[model samples]
Target: MDGGVFANLMHGFSVALQPSVLAYAFAGCVIGTLVGMLPGLGPLAGISLLLPATFGLNPIIAIVLLAGVYYGAMYGGSTTSILMRIPGEAASVMTCIDGYAMTQRGRAGPALAIAAIGSFVAGTLSVVALMFLAPTLASFALRFGPPEYTGLLLMGLFVLAYMSGGSMLKTLAMAAVGLLLGMIGIDAMSGYTRFSYDVIELADGIGIVPVAVGLFGLSEILLTAGQPTPPAIQRPTLRQLIPSLEEIKLSVGPISRGSLIGFLIGIIPGSAHIISSFVSYGIERRMSTHPERFGKGAIEGVAGPESANNSAATGAFVPMLALGIPTGPITAVMLAAIMVHGISPGPMLITQQPDLFWGFVASMYVGNVVLLILNLPLVGLFVYLLRIPYSYLYPAILCFCILGVYSVSNSVVDVWIMLGMGAFGYVLRKTGFEPAPIALGLILSPMLELSVRQSLAMSGGSYGIFFERPIAITMFAAAGVLILLGLKPLLFKRKDWREKVGLEDQV
Candidate 1:
């Protein structure tokens, strides 16, 4: 409503609505769907490989394309998950639970249809939330000082720890490692480089794109190399792809609730689509009258978690745009991309850089439409992607990742760093640890230090600063309770027991 802000926004829409940007948006969606339809290659890797190409593009055009890729992958991932039982990314893993089951039972069409619809509904709903809520949220966040940020960071770390895979001690160690990795760049206050290792390549610090792609993409290829290739998918026809009206009616409530839950969790740092999907699945199962139907190809199972995952992907954009915080690893890559183009995502970004923000927002609407068109009619095309031999697919993914790493500032050193991280990621995978927390820590490192130091300075080096602020105190307390609950064997053990009981009954 402010004159300057309104004017800037109008300019942003002008750029976003341009015919050329729309074409790039469509191209990004198409590429995303293709990569997402494949099992090993994911958006992070795809974007990493493409980042070098975008270097020559206008910042707005580049981001519009990348954002489209991001969400289109979300849509495409569900396709492979439902039809082939292989998740395109970590978040889509939950979709495999019921989706693959539906495929086995010859319900692949309805399953894919439901997922596509749920993703569209959730993505649109979250975008609407972003349109109206981002400025408001940024205004509210302006009140935050050092104590609040510290509290928020602490909460982020704990949430990641709780949500990470088995072995709390190992997860803690991984997180510490991530926090230390985050300390690699220069110390903000003193202007001292803490862990540069006398290397010039590190002076600008490690790029999140190479690190993320290495961890998630390369490690995935290595992991899949040892496992048996997934079973082939039986293609579904157009008639099979369309869900009945009754199925749509049944899914509406879950899709709506999932959008809300996914969006809220996504705004918090360290929360990712995986966490949202799992939580959404649990909630949907509990609320369903026939909870037993969940693992038995329940329509709600396919709808709720897919919607939540996609919505969470959309919601993760909010904090990145408003608070200058990268909520997850993928967005961390996007943040790095923005900064690499000499732009920062922060509070002033909205007013000073409304063209970038609103252009990106408008492009999302166009991207959603593009995704539906590319994903739906071409559902068969995407399914065909699953038919590619693992031998060929894995190598292509590796080659792309290698090229992506080598392309970063044309530094061979980054390639070495990427390989090192890939090996480390493989180890973590073998040990049942999720790479996401490491990615979270790597991205949050600089922010964490800034907050910690600022809070200390504000409190004259007193540690009690974190406890003094009400919002900070509340979030930390909630984090503490969740940590205790996570460590305790009660809820998860009970839930596992119940699931076992349910499985036995079916047997």
Candidate 2:
């Protein structure tokens, strides 16, 4: 290890291992596990629901708590997926196929054990990668000026919109709306508010906290409430927690491949944890000698996807910490929390705030170990948590969301804003729109606007600056390519669309 990197990491462990920090880290993990095992609440909601409470916390500690929730939820999701055919979060959805199949075949123990172990391995490795990669990236990013930043942020948004599942057009539409909404507050360079009407609440702009909690958290609650409650869970005994040597041997390759895949994909901007999980599952299924064993309690199914999701979840930190970009909803909320605590995130953050940077990194390692320890021996306890009915749980969560958002600004207006956004979110959900692009758009809008305006100002009101810089041109070109690639199917789909329309009409 380089002296500089090693020194920063040591300082990080020193802060992270302190008794108070450790206690809060433990609490965050426990809270994450509790919320995560619930059918609907994912890390995004979990972080959003708890954000307002961090108003009084130290920046590093607040991040330690919230960051713990992020990855802890990743680990927690597999429990219900394996036991009850319920996915604790979006990433866990892939696990439900073979995980539930294993439960039916009375091999849930092996599945659960492999998932926990794989998550630990991947989580640890990814954090180490993050520790190394982020600093190097930040060093490289030091050369970025406003025009370069403008192009990069633009690239990020387009790449995110294109990679988000479903119609790229729909995702871009949501992103544009989100960016417009994010522009409601103030023009940083011009000192003028762009979209806020005469309303008092809109003056400082929409709070990301209220919007996030409402859009992802409350909307999910409303959607789940509209459906019938899930069936009762079937509990598995702890005595069967042991995985056979054969099972462990079978899992090794998937875990290794999944970890690498997840880490690489996680660095990209969009649905990475979920994407990595699905991709790993596909790869594992294809690589299997006994391909037919898949979807029928194949251990590789659980091992690969679970590891990939965790690794990807950890890999997402790279961009956020290094370049001040959010790759997904989880990082969006984390960015919100850090910014709310009055810390600016960017390439300079590593040098400007090494403690916060490395401390949070070290804390992730601690949180990973903490989750692994808690998840295994306490499997029975988590299974009991799954048995708790959504009937009773949703109401309490609804109340919590209300209280959390209200606490953000101590304003009833924020609460109303939250409810309004929640309704809008439900509409989006029902209509097949992904909320992630919107979340990214909303969080990143101000930065995007700032960069563009700054670039324009530097160019003396000319648009040519974006094209003049080699880096800026490359970024814009990359975004353009992604857009073209996304449109490629549509460019050739006239006959296919007609065939589908004809087939649907016959149906």
Cα lDDT of all candidates, in order? 0.80, 0.83
Local accuracy of candidate 1 as per-residue lDDT tens digits, 1-507: 365545645765687789989999999998888777766678888787778788888888888888888888888889878877788877788788889898999989988988988998899889888877788778888888877877777787787676543455666677788888878867778888878989987877777776787788888888887578778777888888888788788799889988998888788877478778877787788788889788878888889888998899889999899888888777876776788789977766776677788888878877887787777777887677678778877887788888887886799888888888888899988887767777778888888888888889889989898888898888889789867866665544643322322322321
Q: How close is candidate 2 to the true structure, as a TM-score?
A: 0.92
lDDT of 2 by residue, 19-94 (tens): 8889889999988887778765778778877887887788899999998888888889998888887778878887
What's model 1's TM-score?
0.92
Model 1 lDDT at residue 385: 67
Task: In angstroms, give how far residue 283 of model 1 lies from its true place.
Answer: 1.6
The number of the candidate with the highest lDDT is: 2
Model 1: which residue pairs collide? Answer: none
